[model samples]
Target chain A: MAVFVDLNISHTVDKKRLQNIIETAAHLGYSTVAINHVVDLQQKKQEIGKPKCVSELFDQFPIVQGKSRPIKVLNRLTLVVSEASHFRPTNEFKSYDVVAVFPKTEKLFHAACMSFDVDIICIAVTEKQPFYFKRPPVNGAIDRGVFFEISYVPAIKDSTMRRYTISNSLSLMETCKGKNVIVSSGAEKPLELRGPYDIANLGLLFGLSEGDAKAAVSTNCRAVLLHGETRKTALGIIHTMKKIEPTAERREEEEAPVLKRARTEAV
Target chain B: MVRFKSRYLLCELCVSDQSSLQLLDDRAVFTGVRGAVCRAHGDYGAALCSVSFAVKYLNADTGVVFLRCRKSHYRILWSALPFITHLENRGQKVPCAFNCLYVGGTIRTCQKFLIRYNIQQLHRMLPHCHNEAERLEVRRAVLNCSLKSLEKEEEEDE
Candidate 1:
């Protein structure tokens, strides 16, 4: 089974609340969750600092229901860009596992979708989508393996926000044809978080087909994680560190068992 | 006999306070679901939903609800079930959401599944009882329910 993942839990100042949210996520069968720290550069002098260590969130990580493994927590940084200069890729961007961009204008939206090397382009949930999702940029993002994210927490919190969330996601789905889209809960509290299956069903209301809706919770999120991994290496290869020596004896011994079994079967 | 095609949804209304469940009934649930579908899926969904949607059974005590809809449009209604945050009743609002447990082709199958699902839930709750008294009480309840259900099944079989 594809392990369910909720890749956008909103980072909160209250440690206890954040811990409760993560525990609820684990109980809801999320195998992995990303704590998103948002930076709105529209505010003056907003410095993007390194994300806090995810390990400090809990003493022992809560085990995912039905999976019997501790939920994997990851750090993410989201930059809300209103203007062109709002987003700058500093070394701080490399500290997090996933980077997301919420563009506030048509220019920034196009830029974030096409040229920006972020993993996710966050669609507006709290308000109406400011600019229309033009075909070229959205298609370019998909071609570049970047995912468009729609957060559901806002919908849970308010009815007006629910209208925006459903409309915005439908617009994105219209142009993207439900490809390379991820639905995540930007839940600041435990109550805002819904189960993965619930979100998958909610995706249908967002204009996604049944299979694509399920993928929004599982496979597409995995693709986004892999996209983040590739950003760290050169073409996903060519590491700067020296290579370690392999044990030739161990390699031969590992090969010998399979070979001996094959020879015995042949005899 | 020609039978009309229909779908039955077995759902559980999750509420923080059990007292709030009393406020939920067939009409309130119907209104909540209709409003949610209209808001989320729009007028077209609302029109499609009013076709044959009905609340067949509702157990306020256990929070179980059986919603019946046309087979062709059950998916649309199923998608809207999660959006129901609360049901308004008698000038008061109760915070709750519906978690769909099973969708069956017939009410008979849904009832069968609900019994099995309730038993599984009871088994899960047994370990969480706080003290010896609570544990024993839960055990007796479980045994009583199983015996009653088994006897009912035997009567039906005969």
Candidate 2:
């Protein structure tokens, strides 16, 4: 089975509350979760900062239900880019495991879909989607393996947001044709987090087919994680590992093989 | 004659407080499910679920509920279950979530699945028993369940 992943748990300053959310996520059977730190460049003096180390949050991570393994937590950075000049690739971006962009304008959305080096592009759920999802940009995103994300927390919070969330996602689904779409909870509280199967069911409400709905929470999220990893590496295909040096015992073995051959020839 | 088919959904209501389970009844759960279906799928879903939809059983102590709906519209109810954030009983809102355990075509099948599920849960809790008494209690519970089911099967056979 593809492991379920929730890629957008809203970051909070309260350590205890954050831990509580992660615990709830593990209980709900999410195998992996990403703590999201959002930076909106529309504000003045906005600068990207280094994300905190994920290991420092919990001494012993809560085990995911039914998986018998401790949940994997990762740091994610979401850049709310309203302008082309707002987003700058910096070393700070490398510290996080995943990068996402929330574009506020049509031009920025097009750019993000076509060429932005980010794993996810968040669809607006709080307010009405000001611009329609054009087929070309959405198709470009699908072809490039850049997943469009729809967060359902707002929908659970209020009816108005629910309408917006459903409508916006439905429109996106029309253009993307249910491919390269991921559904995650932008949950701030533990109650906001829904189960993976529940989210998959909710995906059907958002206009995804049955199989695509399940993938939006599982396999599609995995693809997003792999995409994020590729952002850090050289095209995600080539990886480098540290080489281990030969020990003294290995050197003696090599010498013993040569010595044995010489002795056998002499005999 | 072709009989109408229905789907029985077995769900567990998870709450932050154990006492809140008592606040839930069949009526509350029924309305909660209906309202969630209305909210999620709108008028069409509400109309579809309104027919042959009922809460068959509710166990407050175990927080288990059995909901029956027409097989054609069961997906509407199943999909809307996760949206039920709370149930209002006596003008007080008790926060809860419904975790679907199983969905079966018949009530008897749902009952069988629930019994097996409870036994599995008991076995999982067996290791956590601190004393012999607790272990014995769990074993007794498991045995009593199987004995009851066996009696039911024999009675049906007769």
The top-ranked prediction according to lDDT is 2
Which candidate number has the best DockQ?
Answer: 2
Cα lDDT tens digits for candidate 1, A116-146:
9899999999988888999999999999999
DockQ of 1: 0.28
Q: Give per-residue CA lDDT, model 1, range B24-115, as digits (tens).
A: 78898888888988876789988897788888888889988988889989888887776677789888999776767678998778878887
lDDT of 2: 0.86
Q: Poorest 10 consecutive residues of model 2 chain A by lDDT?
A: A234-243
Q: Which stretches of candidate 1 lie over 4 Å from their true place?
A: A156-160, A232-267, B41-44, B59-62, B111-141, B150-158
The stretch of ten residues in a row with the least summed lDDT in candidate 1 chain B is: B149-158
Q: Clashing residue pairs in candidate 1, if any?
A: none
Q: Runs in model 2 with CA error above 4 Å?
A: A238-267, B115-158
Error of 2 at A18 (Å): 2.4
The CAPRI category of model 2 is acceptable
Per candidate, chain B TM-score?
A: 0.86, 0.87
